[model samples]
Target: SQKIEQNSEALNIQEGKTATLTCNYTNYSPAYLQWYRQDPGRGPVFLLLIRENEKEKRKERLKVTFDTTLKQSLFHITASQPADSATYLCALDPPSGAGSYQLTFGKGTKLSVIP
Candidate 1:
């Protein structure tokens, strides 16, 4: 029985600061990890993807690190802004042969940027 957990709480921070969110898991191994940005009442948009062999992945102001040994991933947003405020989700692709490419996402961490 594998499980994924995120902050589960809103993170409030000042603009231009860096916001870090954590994602932890247990049990099974995943083929890959993905991070997504989701706005209120909308589906998540893909941000970064890291494979089991990879240590880190980056996109623009965002960075994500995957540690298979620890069964965890860390997502970072640098120089944050009000527009950057949103719920971030970390998903893991189930081991191959599951019959789908869909991802299992954590509950997500809500981030709020202050002016």
Candidate 2:
């Protein structure tokens, strides 16, 4: 059995700070990992993807690090703002040959920015 968990708390912070979140799993090894962002009542939008063999990945205002040995992933949002407030989701691709490549996502961590 595979399971992914993200922080359920709403992260409240001021603008211009970095927001960090964690994702953890147990009892499964995934072929890859993905991160997504979601606004209320909306579908998640892909932000980053990292393969099992890779260590870290980054985009303009975001960065992600994966550690297979630790079965975890870290997501960071730099220079956070009110517009950056949203739920961040961490998803995993099931181990190869499991029939489908669809992602299984954590419930997500809610981020809130106060101006």
Candidate 3:
């Protein structure tokens, strides 16, 4: 069976520091990877997407890296602040030979930035 994983515990950080999140997947080949930020009681918002062949991507303070060989992705946020806090999620579609696919999300990592 395919599996996706993220930190179950919350991360607490002071203002102006970097917050890192990890996503690991196994037993499948995904064509693309996506990262999203979700606040409590709301849906996730797309942040970045990286193809299987891409190594890294960045937009403003957010960056995402994909490694097909390792079947893992790393998400980073620099210059963190209180407003930057949220549960971040990574998603991917595992190939189903039937030509049908759906996006699967990992349990998000909660980030807390102290003032």
Top-scoring candidate (TM-score): 2
lDDT of 2 by residue, 1-115 (tens): 5799886667888899999999998877787899999999999999999888888899998999999899999999999989999999999987678898677889899999899
Q: How many backbone clashes does candidate 2 have?
A: 0
Q: Which is better, 1 or 2, measured by TM-score?
A: 2
What CA root-mean-square deviation does each model show from the true structure?
Answer: 1.3, 1.1, 1.3
Query: Which pairs of residues collide in candidate 1?
Result: none
Task: Give the Cα lDDT of each candidate.
Answer: 0.90, 0.89, 0.89
Candidate 1 — which residues are off by over 4 angstroms?
Answer: none
**Candidate 3 on 1-115: residue-level lDDT in tens?**
6689986558888999988899999988788999999998998999999998889999999999998888889998999989998999999886857476778889889999999
Any idea what lDDT model 3 has? 0.89
Would you give me the overall lDDT of model 1? Answer: 0.90
Cα lDDT, model 1, residue 24: 94
lDDT of 1 at 37: 94
TM-score of 2: 0.94
Show model 2 residue runs off by greater than 4 Å: none
